[model samples]
Target: MLVLGIDTSCDDTSVSVYDAKENRVLSNIVSSQYSFHREFGGVVPEIAARKHAENIDLVFEEALEVAGVGVKDLNLISVTNRPGLLPALLVGLTFGKGLAYSLSVPFKAVHHIEAHIFSPFIGSEPEYPFIALVVSGGHTLIVLVEGFGSYSLLGKTLDDAVGEAYDKVAKLLGLGYPGGPVIDRLYREYDGKYLELPKPKVKGFNYSFSGIKTAVRRLVEKGYPAEQVAASFQETAVSYLIGKLKKALKETGVRRVAVSGGVSANSLLRERLKELDVDLYLPPLEYTSDNGAMVAYVGYRRFLIEGEDTLEVGALARCPIS
Candidate 1:
């Protein structure tokens, strides 16, 4: 089956064509709006939505062209319709619906986080009854995955997501937008000693990054070196994430774990995960961010199990995976 996936969950306009029969992604095209949101130091919802509207069509065409497929050849159209910026989600959802209607194919509404959960298993089947740690710009949560279409929300952020905390800290340290990569780079390049940041004491598997972010701000206000502050913050944040994952692994007794979302691409986090004595799955860098490949792959899997969604389904700004 040929499935076309569209995802405009945040600042990226991504489109992909997945060949289910071959279990491979034919094409995955992403157009990032980093340049537009850079000066603002973060994503502006209105600007992201506008850019998605302007870019989605061209991205869709390019995806199909690269995949060597035609609209008529696509058997299903999958789109991210929930748990994202409302305006941005609507742009992709509306366009996907139109294409599905024109081509007379099934329309599938995919959950953004759920797509991230299975991103690493795109070309291969995922082992069931594992743990999923999803960390990203807009979300931070852990889940117990029993099987396809079966998920138990383990815990999530009570405040800012980890990636958001990174961005906020970077802005405080005079770094540019899309903070993760730059901060990661600084953490490696700077030999400056890091400040002692407090670890948030959130109960259970839940996370709280707002406290860490505020602590970093105070250190910056105290005139600490920017590189030291960046290094300190990154170390603390990534350690916190790993600490929680360890807790979850021990408590749940799940031996297999998969980490997804943009933050999963962190070098420190990846290095730490390798130290654990359990099976680990991480998506290639391309699938780490908000992209259509994972969305399309999950859509195809969900469609096989739950069939298609009604055309009347609407976009949602906040939706739970449970």
Candidate 2:
């Protein structure tokens, strides 16, 4: 079946078409709002919603055109409806519902994080009962995945997420908006031996990055070079992630591991994962961030079982995976 997926969960307006039978994505289009929100240092919910409204139709047209399929050919429509900005989620949800209603097709609502967890399966499938580490701007969690729609959240961030920490640190160092990519690039330019950032000692599977972020502030105030600070920060942050993931692997005894979300695209993270001595699944860089393909794939899976959602289904600001 051909499924159309829309994601307006955050600062990206995305649309994609997936072919369930072929296990292939026909088209995936993402219009980033980074340039729009850069001046503000972070996403402005209202502006993100408006951008989605303006681009959703054009994105839809692009997706259909790229897929070489018309609206009537779509068997189902799916959209991210929860765990994101309320207004942004509504833009995609409303558009998806309208399309489904007009096309007389089944409509499904997908969780944004769930889509992240399923990202690794976009191009290749993995065996069941694998560990999923979802690290992104808004969320960080280690989940135990038993099967489709079956997830056990093992640990999550107690405060700010890793990506948020990156952005905050970048801002404190006078770096530009969307800190992850910038810091990741700059950190490689210089070895970070000048600064020693604190790694959070928080116990259990849960994570805490607020302390690390503060450490960056203090070190920067001490007149450390921004490049060295960025490098030190990235190393410490990624180390925390690796430590937590190792703990999860030890506890769960799951040999197969998959990582998703924007931060999963980090070179350091991928390099560390490769040395873990297990079957590792990492999504291509395109699927690492917020994109319509991940949502479309997850939606296609759900549509095969539960089918359509009622018209009453609405958007939500915060929805957790149980």
Candidate 3:
């Protein structure tokens, strides 16, 4: 089947065409709003929504053109509908619904996070019942995936997510917006051993980045080299994540592990996961962050079993896959 996916959840406008028969993405396009939000040191929801309004059509056209298919040729339409800025979600969902209706084809609303969870499956072998660590700007979660749409929440952050902490700390150090990339770059430039930060002592498989964020704030006030501070913070955050992932593996004894989400693009996280003795599936750098290809893949999978969503399906601010 051929599916077109749309994602305007947050600051990125992404669209893709997936050909399930070939198990490949025909075209995946993502227009980042990072440059627009950089001055504000974070995403401005109003600005994000407006940008999506401007770029959605252009992105859709580009995706379809690159995929070498017209809208009439598509068998299904999928769009992210929940757990995002309401205005942003509305833009994509409305466009998707309109397109599906005009084409007289089945369309489905996909959960943004669920799309992240299944992202690694695009063009890769199917590995079911694996542990997934999905760390991103808005969320940090570890889930046990048994199959498509079947997820068990293993652990999640108690307060600020890992990516949120990264942005806040970058602001404290006068780093630009979308701090995860900046900090990851700095981690390679400086030696982090000089500035030691305590890892949070949270119990079980859950995560807690708030304490680490607070500690970074204090360290910034005390005066430390920005590069060292950035490096240290990145290391500590990755360590915390790796600790929980290890615990999850031991507890559940799942030999397969996959990491997804925006933060999953971190260089350190990938390098660290490589050392672990298990079957690892890490989406390519492009798919690690938000993208439409993953959404399309999940949509096609869901449509096979559940069929299309009713036009009444509304966007959700926050929803869990479980």
The candidate scoring highest on lDDT is 1
TM-score of 1: 0.98
Worst 10 residues of 2 by lDDT: 191-200
State the local distance difference test value for candidate 3: 0.91
The stretch of ten residues in a row with the least summed lDDT in candidate 3 is 191-200
lDDT of 3 at 96: 94
How does candidate 2 fare on TM-score?
Answer: 0.98
Q: lDDT per prediction?
A: 0.93, 0.91, 0.91
1-322, model 1: which lDDT tens digit per residue? 9999999989999999999999999999999999999999999999999999999999999999999988889999999999999999999999999999998999999999999999989999998899999999988998999988889998899999999998888899889989999999998998867789998898899999999998998998899888899999989998999899899999999999999999999998999999999999999999999999999999998898999999999999999989
Model 3, total clashes: 0
Higher-scoring candidate on lDDT, 1 or 3: 1
lDDT string for model 3 (40-85, tens) is 9988989999999999999999999999998899989999998999
